[model samples]
Target: MPPATLSRTEQSYLLDGLRSKPAERADRRDLHEYRMMQVDTDLSLQADGSARVVLGSTEVHCGVKAEIESYDAPHVNVSTDLEFAPWLPPSPRVQVMVEYSPALLHEHNATELAMITDTVQDMLQACYALTGNSIGPLDARQFIVVPYARYWVLHLDVYVMSWSGGNVLDAVFAAAFCAMYQARIPGTKILALDKAAARQDDEVDQDDPAGIKFITRGRKPSSSAALDDAVDFALENEWDHGRLLAGREDVPVCISIYPFEDTYLLDPTLEEETALSSSIAVLASARGHIYGIRQRGSGELTLDAIHKAADVGASYAKQLAQTLQARFV
Candidate 1:
């Protein structure tokens, strides 16, 4: 069967509503308003952690799974970007001075993997509030390099089975936070390493790394967190750089927004998403600093709107941070 296509008028109607402001109504309702309820959830026996996020009627389930592998190569530095880039010739001196940026794969699966990797990294940073402003490449110290053999590595997998729009990023972020809070990374003590040895002759014992010290207790994989109150604590202390993250707080709060047409929405639904042509995502810190901004679609944006959107997002985000911190910290 042939696929159905929208007539020009139908497309224009959607475009207009999404891009232009609607006729002013007697009652002034802002462009974006959303309400979400956490409905049902379950544990992932096969995954490190997982959860189901329900935004009103829409539902999305996210799972986190991880494995440790021997570090290979210098430690692959993963970078994230919103749009696809077309290659261009480098300047004469630029090529000589800087490392060539590698070309991204043209395959669908590869592209998807790239996106997944980026999302997982973001999820980790958001959940843990890790230090160092570095992006793209993993730091050398984070990986133990083995030239010809395996090195220790951590891999995180996230699955999005269902989605309804209110902010998949928010849902995914919340889910990932839950999952990581419940995740188990077996604590390890460094074993002695002989200076002059290869894997074949290495004396480092794999069976037990130094000694397995019981620092963080292990828990049976359950559907929910044992420390539910921690979420409240996180909300209280907040994710301020020195204040909350330095062993003082629990969860850091963030606000993100999607821009459509000319009107901006605070939180968008699936119907609104389907009607829009493009979106720009902005994330702000509690201190009113712009952490990240990304334009996800082909939609155009004006500097004025961009400035206004950041202000809007930051305003909402600060409130969220304070609320969460009040509950937790």
Candidate 2:
């Protein structure tokens, strides 16, 4: 469908309907109802994990890629993105990218597109802070190629193929969430090398195929991290497909609400979004824990409105998770 180019007459028609005492949606959905979303996984043969989500006419594709890296690299300036967490000294981290097709330039300027992608990335990073998988000896070791020396840098790329409606961030996050759920990291094994078998390059990785074993040890690995140098690990039977990860339930569901003063809209269309006073996107779990909050539009939001929207979003997230849980199984 072409961009929702509404004339003054069409705009008034929509605003009038929405501004009424009992707001009416053109699609006939309840005031706070979301359209059904269709999700498909394993779409990319090259990606370790991949999923596509369709919410109404908006479509997003998420692919997960990870590379084992050593701790010797420079530290990421995460202070801007996440609060100081001692456990995060040097562990698995995620890189989320929100890329929109160039065709979307017809509807949004370059600055607008960049801002949207940045906001989505921030929202996801906040959510990751809340759900950064359990990394301990007893827990499932995620992204630990070798204890203390190397870890995985998980890359989550979300492509907005098309945006016909509101909820672009919602759809993007949903696709990323599903893709991470489906993602599997390849297993790693330690091969003790004799001094003779090891290469002569002592400055760094000496003939390290995985680049996990460093010639010299630096900072000690965080105890709360995935693995310790002393901890021994090996999979019973590992394959190219990799192993399914745990803590899928830790992933939060993203829900955005468009607020028109006292009225709110869920899953608004492009035209509907245009008439909104403001919008709030919240990342929350089915258990009602709010992870992050982002506000858009120039209009101010009341504290009461923010509270109500968060509550509504959290409630809806539970239902959405329940609806999709079966497919994950």
Candidate 3:
């Protein structure tokens, strides 16, 4: 039910109970306690990496795809919002997309959906984006094959299968972190680039109107003498030979906090989230480094409240990271 649907009596009861000494929650959980979560990885044989995270009723899946791309693609500078890690390199482009299921869409309107997408994308990009200032510790040795010719580009697709309750951001980020950690970049075989051969392969399209000409890439038959030295790059078929993604343990884990009158809530249910006036999502590493902090509520927050939220997020991040890392070990 929406916040408006909460009866006045119920709201009063909630507020009184929360404000009482040793605040109480709807489920009798401590302020730092979290809902039970289930995580799985290596879910897709085709994807470089894949994982699923289930928290309360929310289920999110993250898949990692890496493709070899040329330098012809346009480059983008670091985004203003991505002031987290400041990762450099235009190649090995990383793209993140978050999509929701029809069932979830029915519960939320376009605005809510947009907000979810935008928030999740920003958090994921801060750590995983290659073009921006990334809080993620993506190592160049993981995907870079050639310096200027070609590189591995990543496509991280996060699909929300369901949203029942609890912190969706935590679920999304956890799934993505595991998937990226499990990612393996394929090995590439490269020969010297043949500039002369490429020049000779340019073909003229004769169908142009008014004597206009369009140049297109042409290929020679395998048996033709022109293609004997044309093979410049190829991928190795053996999966075992591929390199594992670097900084596998460095992805930031996020903890979302909902502040009540004089207390805070961790892993709040949908109703609890709606009732609260403010929310803070802290993206931090298990190694005791703070990546970024996002505040989404309009409630007036004191300095002490912010610090408490950060401390909670940072402390829980280590525990969450341990939980995720255990899966690989």
Measured by lDDT, the strongest candidate is 3
Error (Å) of candidate 1 at residue 206 is 21
lDDT of each: 0.39, 0.66, 0.69
lDDT of candidate 1 over 279-313, digit per residue (tens): 65555545555556656556677888778777787
Candidate 2 structure quality by residue, lDDT tens digits, 1-329: 12366888998999888877677779888777778899999898888889999988899999998776655333222434321213223433676677889988987788878877787777776555423334311122455554335566778788888888667878887887788777877666654322321332222232443333331322223332222224333443443468766566657777888877666788888788776657888887656667777787878988999898888888887777656666787
Candidate 1 lDDT for residue 294: 56
**Candidate that beats the other on TM-score, 1 or 3, i.e. the better one:** 3
Residue 276's lDDT in candidate 1: 56
Top-TM-score structure, candidate number: 3
Model 3: residues with Cα > 4 Å off, grouped in runs: 1-5, 73-92, 130-135, 194-231, 261-263
Which candidate would rank higher by lDDT, 1 or 3? Answer: 3
Tell me each candidate's TM-score. 0.49, 0.76, 0.77
List of clashing residue pairs for candidate 3: 86-133, 126-135, 127-136
Worst 10 residues of 1 by lDDT: 91-100
Weakest ten-residue segment in model 3 by summed lDDT: 208-217
